[model samples]
Target: MDDDDDLTLNLFTPAIKKNVGKSLENVIWGNRQQRIKARKLLKLTARAKPTKTPTLSESQSDVYTEKSEIANNKKRKIADVSLDFDNNKRRNDGSGNVSSTPTKKLKDSLHFSSLFNSNPEIPTIDVKPVECIKEEVFSSDSFESLSLDTYMLRNLRETMKFNQMTHVQEQAIPPILNGSDALVKSQTGSGKTLAYAIPIIHALQAVRPKICRGDGVFAIVILPTRELALQSYEVFRALVKPYQWIVPGCTIGGEKRKAEKARVRKGINVLLGTPGRLADHVIHTKSLHLFKLRYLIIDEADRLFEMGFEKDVKLIIDCIKEKTLKKQTVLLSATLTNGVERLAGMSLESPVRIDVSQDETTCAVTPKIDLHINTRDNSNECSAFSVPDKLKQLFVVTPCKLRLVSLVALIADKCVLAFKKSKMIVFLSTQDSVEFLHKLFSNLFKENDSVSCMNALLSDQQQDIRKSKCLVTFYKLHGNMDQKDRTLTFTKFSTCKNGILLCTDIAARGLHLNNIQWIVQYTTPGDAKEYIHRVGRTARAGAQGNSLLFLMPSETEYVKTLSNMKINMKEIMMRNVLHNLLLLFEKLPKILENDRRPPRTYEEAATTLQIYIEKVVNDEPEMQEVAKKAFQSFVRCYSTYPKHLKSIFHIKYLHLGHLAKSFGLRDAPGGFSAGKNPIQSKKKHFYKQHPCLEIHNPKEYVKKPLSSFYEFASGH
Candidate 1:
């Protein structure tokens, strides 16, 4: 080597040169000796030990210094390596000792957690209902005590069977009747509709000249959804039956614009409509006059803003204000929100804030009819949010694979074979999920002789088992459906004696269905406030109701989060849900019995039902497509949860394969094709850009004659 190369080589330890060109055995031995020497040097450096040095010649001292410098450089490099090793050990195991086994790091890899417990004895904790310290406002006054016209009073007592006033009605009606702009906040199902509706009718009745069809618009009531508009229209229709001269007309988005224009030309005494449709009339329909408008009532005001109807509402308000400045405005909401406050500021003038939910004043009215039996303080009294007092809230922690069977069992046990007529609303996260489950359950509960045929093939002992003849009627409602279909579905579900309505969040707010017995959240809502609105559908008007929430083991943290929001729920074991399902199957042989042997155990029964559902999906190509779409939509919805709830509903922790099983798919869609990962697909973008627009034939878009307008309008 050159002298320069030799100088570079001296910088490293001499152990490197000694190991080079040696036998393999010698090299290994050399490395061991080098490590020993490094360790000894470390000890000497750390201890700073004094070394005896005898007097030597000048050349001898120079060579010794060079050798000592090389030794120090080697010791520093070895010390760095040792310190790194110790740091890694502590980082891996959180201790000085190294871990026995190396942990396999998984980055974006699939794995499943073992959450299913075979033990049948699952413990449950009972949640006690929290009582509010505020005094309850129990109004015993009847409707007669209010200064209402005789015909209105008669309609209230005899026609509507509403003899007594609810606490909200007792407090809100008086202020609204006094012609003061009012902001009202009460619990859901607290007679809020009638609170404003009655006052509007009463004021119109006192007009000197009796109102007629061509009297122009007297009052305009804006609602958040078309279904709510229709519902309010019905209430107005029923209330105005005594005064036939006072006409009530509805103009929502689904109906024909020409027909609504004609109604406006002829004149509507009371108009009820959704914000968008009403705003369209204000802009386009010249005959729709607000010159004589006396009242403007916005029901579900918070929902109005939440649904992105703020601009439409403001447009209608500005137009109404231009027409008349002396009108009374009533803003009503089940919950008070900042958006509602902003809306009130824009519309209401010196508004009387009558919040029966928080008001503690006692009414000095005489007791005529005791209506306390029909009312309870279950609204917002127990918590910051309000739910029906009579609602029995329950939650079940289930494994992803067992989610489908658990829901099936729960519905069969609670709705199908129950002694009384049952009405249930099953809320899903996505529209595709609602559509797929509706089809699956409809086929499973078809009114046919398949169950009887299977029972006939059984032994006489098994044949003797009694069967439930009650048929299950399934209805679906989602935003994607045509307005007419949605309206018809809502109407049919409302009137059906025993039925199940599979729906998305579109039906979560403001539509009051009669006698809703159960609310089943098949998918946990992304927002906690949504849970409050969903469960509020039941236990309405002092009637007893139940709600069941399906949750995975990973989502148990949601229960605690809800508890902090003052929403109490009792835990129901998965074992008990399965047991109830088995009992129902035993009673009703028609469900999932297709000439097959009976299940002997709960596990077997669950497996059989799962296989049966999977067959139903796979056997039909259309259903298989629906299943895939639903699965993809569900995952997309799950991943887009709000930031605060990301910890509880993380997409990384979800088992895609097991989640697909709940949708009746043998494997997840992403696993089926390497090139097409459904989770990362562009379908979500397509839906977002064209939410209400669907691809169809060119002929369908062409305008039709007036005769075929109904078919076109209904999307038939």
Candidate 2:
């Protein structure tokens, strides 16, 4: 029954009240959507109550009006946030002009004094528009033209012997010297190191007194690989050595952490190191400080981001500046990827992008990378473009088993007979191949009497640079070997006038070994970029060279992909493709027919694919999320084949496919589901009900101490 009706009936009679209360059960609220939880019945007083009116003071009226204005300002501030979002979206999209009229009145009325006077906890943040790059830039020619200091010019002319400037150097140096963030893209070995190094040297000289051999680093240059970091450190050392006080340091993997920490703590003015090792010191050890850091140069920037060092890089960037410090960031790379662009957006503030490595002018992938993909499908699709004019490409198509023999005969015809005491580097895809080929060549030299590749350099003018003249025909190098062994092999290879160095991709970068007449590819590399670096090892510094790729018949399909990208290779036969050298095919050993496809078990195929995926993960951590996409892309071409392309690849049961499921790529089979990730709630632990731990002490710890040590000792 309704309470109001029951009260009305109670004022009448008991008999009538029961009937009225039962009838009131059908009564409804004002609206269906709105329901009252409690209803009260009003009663008519017998006598009228006295009425009173109260008046407020003048101060009370003023305070009430002030509170009203603050509430209105809060409403206005909210409107500004939305307006800014819309304006930023339009600006980013390049849709059209944005009218600042929407925010003009609110910004004009903005008064920090009013907001802060009412509430002290509220903060004031200045909203800044997105910064954009300048339209034009200037370039410098010689050291004299750059307006560098006297000492720097002296070093440039006398010590470095640098007379003329390269295109990238002339253009990139001026802006960087002016303390503006810069993004530079140029080809490998295009004097990119010197371009950045000159400006860094100039800046360090200006801040020389402040730079000491203790406390924190002033400048940091991050690289992708350990070898590159070490190489960069060498360049930095040369520049810093002339100036005694300006010390430079390096921290990379494969070093003692305790030593690195001590070095960083002692102080370094300019630092060069790998991202992973640098990140460890800054974050975990807390030894390396970037407090006074003014310059940050990210060399090989594209690879650094691709190798999934973004998180670590950003963490280090955050530690550089607290509020007012402005860090000048410089990014350099051969090819600018989308990741590099995104990195610019995040870190670089209105950076000047100086791109000198245009395809027509610079040829970043110069003497272009020779690519050859051998898909099972016969359908050929490719990009049509001409190869680099200077590069001479030759090929030897052979079965799986005959490759070793073909290499021997080709070397005999090309290097020994035609060009005596010529330098060559054979790039194999794996260490195993390098080891196997080194042995195969040795055996064939003994077996064949007419042709000899051994001890051919004994009579040559250039003796082995090493103390011992072993008279070996070739030296082997790969990552599996110790650092000491690798360095020895590289030194021997670089100095030798006529010898072969069989190695993998470890020799592909930073180590400039000129006078390399030929590059023999044992197999196609993993990708187009890899192909460039591999072939790029040769034809360097404007030198004319030849690259011969040894491919299986099916692998020739990769040519179309390369051709599409303007990397057209001229196919030459095994019989003296270099018109100068005559073929020694007749004297070569008889070849035995072997299986056309690679012989691998299901487990072997899966394991190999897994290893490749792991390598990719080191460069791309986000791939772990979309692993299923990667798997589907690989397996799509092989799905239709009946024997699964001669059992070389086990597509359905790939190890990558199994690993993908763990990274939220798919649901487990048989109705198994992944557990929900634990998410902490936003409700903060407030001290409204709970007493503070500091204030509330336990009774046990409140006990009094003994009067003296002697009494305690006696009691015990």
Please tell me which predicted candidate would have the highest TM-score against the true structure: 1
Per residue, candidate 1 scores C-alpha lDDT tens digits across 432-515 of 898899888877765443346646777765444323223577899887788889889999999887889998877887778988
Q: Give the number of the best model, judged by lDDT.
A: 1
lDDT of 1: 0.69
Error of 2 at 485 (Å): 3.4
Which residue pairs show collisions in model 1?
none
Candidate 2 contains a number of clashing pairs equal to 9
Off by over 4 Å in 2: 1-140, 208-210, 321-324, 359-389, 413-420, 439-473, 577-716
How well does candidate 2 match the true structure in TM-score terms?
0.54
Candidate 1, run of 10 with poorest lDDT: 707-716
